[model samples]
Target: MDNETTTTYRKIIHIDMDAFYASVEQRDNPELRGKPLVVGGPPEGRGGVVATASYEARKFGIRSAMPSKKALQLCPHALFVRPRFAVYKEVSQKIREIFSRYTDLIEPLSLDEAYLDVTDDKLNVGSAIEIAKQIKQAIKDELQLTASAGVSVNKFVAKIASDINKPDGLKFIGPSAIEAFMEQLPVEKFHGVGKVTADKMKKMGLHTGADLKKLTQDELTGRFGKVGKFYYQIVRGVDERAVQPHRETKSMGAEDTFAYDLTTVEEMNDELDKIAQAVYNRLLKYNLKGRTITLKIKYHDFRQITRNQSFPFPVGDLETIGNTAKQLLLASGIDDKRIRLLGISLSNFGEAAVKVKGDEVSEQLKLF
Candidate 1:
């Protein structure tokens, strides 16, 4: 309510490239820009999955991580292209260079997504949203690709707002609108809530942002343990975390919440299909493979659970991935309770991306 309470919040910007790899393909090849282009593996390439697809490809339901074979089924005519990680990394560097010109407090989640803390920058940018626009313009002009930006008082809302509109879009969540903004958000879409937590919340009759705001911190933390604290703050738009540059990215993964909870093993298997697709899509983008696969579940009473399995060989195939995750989920006998959300994460990383190493490694490579 007071100015001190308000000023304590920092200005954060989340920047995400629009169909990153696909946009790069469109940028280099004049013919691919407007046409439906799939920048991934060969359609007939065995074990291949889509990394990124242009907006045109999306019309055919040729989405990222859909097997190249399945994507062909959806859009046989869609153009299929292999990932050019070298070129993309170059573009990523160029964009990051542009960001450094504004502020050094930039935390890159991946090559495509980053969080910038510009609350007390030397650049003297007037408004957070304005700074986002300028950065987007710079990326467009210099890199020849589009990016979507979100600006807010802190990281949680800014990340969500960035995705509200995609591919050359900008969204702002001013401090005045934070409460209303959070109240309307779906519980499943909360940044750290993930699929498991969302399912639990739903079974507890919590669905929307308004529902979450009503729950006490003790109740949430009692149910979710440490993550409960995150839920408690985000529902009230009270993220206090700073934008940490040089943040260590130990791994990359993805998860999704279901519209309906699962009661039967059959139903859970169906959910794994979707989770596998999501994880595979992220794997392709990060060009990463992992030895460990984790299955996350949320029960009927807001109870969160996780089960994981490790492999001697790296996992890059979809069927093996889905089956592995399903086995872990059922192995835990977690099916007795009704489930609301299912998620999969491939972690325990062994190395940097095969195509793109960390900035430090790249610097070393340059020296050699």
Candidate 2:
């Protein structure tokens, strides 16, 4: 093919490892291979929610982040293991090293997921699908782990296609095949559209991707605000968002719904402390020193609200975390109400060492 003709097609790949942490444990200990293994905390106490589960556990409707008691109720024979972040991170680095051989345009969504743009690769790969197959096989053979990959002309299609088939699955979507591929795609599957958006779309008579396309841009924009433009383009299978690396940091946080609404200051404080630790851990890992601390609270009636305060200096200390959270709690002045959820987030991150997107403007936007 002519060079100009070749330049018309962009090659993008999204690779996600299959049940990463749980799979790693199973791979290292063959005895755990066929069992329904869950990785997280113990299956007894309040903090025991599964972080990852083997595919066998999934068949029993046991899923990640589900309560350990609930998972055991679903799969009584399931095996539970503690989370090993160090091991998973090591495997992730190894996987990224493998991708560097094909393209340096890599944007990691998480330790187990990433987007790769190979349009200007030095490897001179002729076929995107062939490259995806090779990457998957390499992961399996070298790491003794399974991975699913999607190859497409852009990031959006590649991400969605990657999940079409799971655990050693590979799918491709070319420019000519975009229309057929999107015809039956659910609104819930659209990029950036979550369960809340899906419900809103359903109420607006939009069910499938085709149905979403019928709405005027203004209509979708009115419904979705700023992200409507993305929805419109996705419905038409036209996402211009490049898979460039080094996108900046915008916001980070953690939230949790309680099994029962908490009515006391002590109970709320306990939950807030846990959330703060989670936020701080992530901040330390990413080397993010944030100046703002936010607290989110939800009442028994589902009336949710948030409060935030900016500090003079970037903070990552537990004392600052607790105090900022307490200040927010006092500011909300909802002590009489039964709190159903608590969340803590550190934002206003300063300069970071890594970039996730190539465009400086996009990096400033801090979009994922």
By lDDT, who's the top model here?
2
lDDT of each: 0.78, 0.80
- Specify the poorest-scoring 10-residue window by lDDT in model 1: 359-368
User: Please, what are the lDDT tens digits per residue for candidate 1 over residues 136-248?
Assistant: 99998887889999999989999999999986999998998998989999998888777887898899999998987788889888887877778888888888888777544
Give candidate 1 regions above 4 Å deviation. 1-6, 249-368
The segments of candidate 2 whose C-alpha lies over 4 angstroms from its true place after superposition are: 1-7, 252-287, 295-307, 316-344, 350-368
Candidate 2 per-residue C-alpha lDDT over 36-141 given as tens digits, one digit per residue, 9 for 90 to 100: 9988756663446778899999999988768788989899899988766667778888998888888988888888889998888768887778888889989989
